[model samples]
Target: MAVAWYRARLVESRPQTPTARTLVLRAPGWPGHLPGQHVDVRLTADDGYQAVRSYSLAAPTDGDRIELGVQSVPDGEVSPYLAEDLPAGAEVEVRGPLGNWFVWRPGGTDPVLLVAGGAGIVPLTAMVRARGEAGSPAPFHLLYSVRGPDSLWYRDHLAEDTPGLDVRIVYTRTAPPGTSRPPGRVTAADIPGVPAGRVYVCGPTDFVEAVDDLLIDLGRDPATIRTERFG
Candidate 1:
């Protein structure tokens, strides 16, 4: 649950979307992190002001280096620095590849359903990456929702054809030309075929709650679903 804060250097900062960046960080002795784990990043100002924020790990568990996806919040304190201002070699205070309740490990052939909205795709992507690294044939499905094409993260990566995985996208506000579906919220119809076991949902608090309700209405037992939410 707790780990010592250490200095992590930003080795690479890759843009996932217009508003989000994935910072690849390497620590001297990275203890490694499980899929869906997160780390706290701390920033200090020249005037001695400090801001701390938690960012989800965006990469697989196979490496000493990890990626943290940061979506800049409007008028926020930390993300702006992380997404834009922070240099590649900048040092950051980081703590824990934290959280246990939301993790996905490499085992079992049960189907995995991952529902994500906006930046919530971060941790779930980690799970997908972990599954790929382990070469598990488990069926993994991702149902992702966003306002428009611009809001979608990991655009190129998502378009890639990963084996044993299926991704469905729902556009809430706008879609490309010749789309029949209206811009609206995701319903049970947006997702088809419930996984045989536990389903994971991550997104804004409201999105998580609504999806949870919808899943239940679709006859999924509430106890078998796990959720991690961000504001």
Candidate 2:
């Protein structure tokens, strides 16, 4: 399919965590998107210089607005612009809903295991939302790893609303003094008890690679696992 650019209006923007923010864009005439797809955002300056970044859509496919969960890197150019500079009602150029065969649609029969590191959970969150809304028979599980609670995206949503999905949050840095959750990266033991089915993973290149290796060591079918790496 051809890529189309839309002039989208920022409708809502809020901090999902101390380091990440969720931005909602409203583009009335923009074509809708599929789950697990991403969009390219272009930022321009008065000097005519521009930068672009690709971000996965966090909202469910059925939602009218596109949601992006952005985490700020130490000196990330585009992320800082999005997280700090951009404000609600700002117009932006977005070309999106693009990908090949990576979508997770509702009504599927197989159970889904999502492994995410840091902001990688964005796309999988959309899948979880879609399945929950459709009341699909398949089971959903999530293994999300972050430095700590401060960097965990969508922590409140997962805590309050994800009653139907199995979620395990792993923290790898200095945990709060009394935290009871696992205080290291995700391991094979962290995965929930479920039958072999589909596994989707996303994270930094090294993190994704390590998780893939862990899955293999756990006797999971390599062919059933899919991965997408960023950074």
Candidate 3:
């Protein structure tokens, strides 16, 4: 079957952080996707100019709706519109549910370790939501590095208990009040006691590369890790 572009209607939108928003889109007849999949969204301007960007699904596949977390990039062609301007009931052209290497399914029993930097949490959050929705018993750990507590997306959702989910946050620029960890970049020492498992890391190109090298130096097999860079 030939691939096709589909129309996605914005059903809901909410703040994920000060600079980002999560949009829930309704697409009928949409085939479901595995966690970590992304969609290419296309927007057309009044003068016929168009821009396209790929955003990962942030929630577990339910049936007809999918959630996307978009961060507004300064002077960006597409991100600013999606993150801060798009309104509910508007329609956007989308293609995909693309990618395979970075996806996770409920069948795996290995411990799931997720590492995120900034907006990269989009896909990792999907895996977290998937694990809970499927009632999968696999142990899950997330080491999320962000600028500060205020920049974190899905802060409330992440804080909610979903059995077997463990999270540790690292502050890069500033830490919250009464915090024990000083604001600093995530180093090799910040990793939780996660056993050898399927590790997924997502972030900017440089961040992903550094984490990949760090994981390798820590004695992790390169083959066991999957990564996606989205800067």
Q: Report clashes for each candidate as comma-separated counts.
A: 0, 0, 0
Cand. 1 TM to true fold: 0.96
Tens-digit lDDT track of model 3 for 1-231? 555678999999999888899999998878889999998999988999988888999987878788998998999988888888888899998887789889998888899889999999999999998898888889999999999888998888699987899998999999999889899988999987688899999999988999889898899989989999976
* Decreasing lDDT order of the candidates: 3, 1, 2
Estimate, for each residue in 1-231, the C-alpha lDDT of model 2 and write its tens digit.
Answer: 579888888998998877688899987676788778889999888899988899988877544589988887779989987987798799888997787565787878888899989889999888877787788878888888888767778766688555558887888986777778647877778776668888999989999999999988888899988898899
lDDT of 2 at 230: 95
Q: What digit string (tens of lDDT, one per residue) describes model 1 on residues 1-231?
A: 458887889999999888899999887778888999999999888999988999999988645687999999989888998998999899998988799999998897888999999999999999988898899988998999999888999877689899888998899999867778788899989986955777999999999999999999899988889999999
CA deviation > 4 Å runs, candidate 2: 62-64, 161-163, 176-182
All candidates: CA RMSD (Å): 1.3, 1.8, 1.1
- The 10-residue segment of model 1 with minimum total lDDT is 58-67
Top model number, TM-score: 3
Better of 1 and 2 by TM-score: 1
- Write down the TM-score of every candidate: 0.96, 0.92, 0.96
Candidate 2, residue 224: Cα displacement in angstroms equals 1.2
How accurate locally is residue 218 in candidate 3, as Cα lDDT from 0 to 100? 91
Candidate lDDT scores, in order, read 0.89, 0.83, 0.89
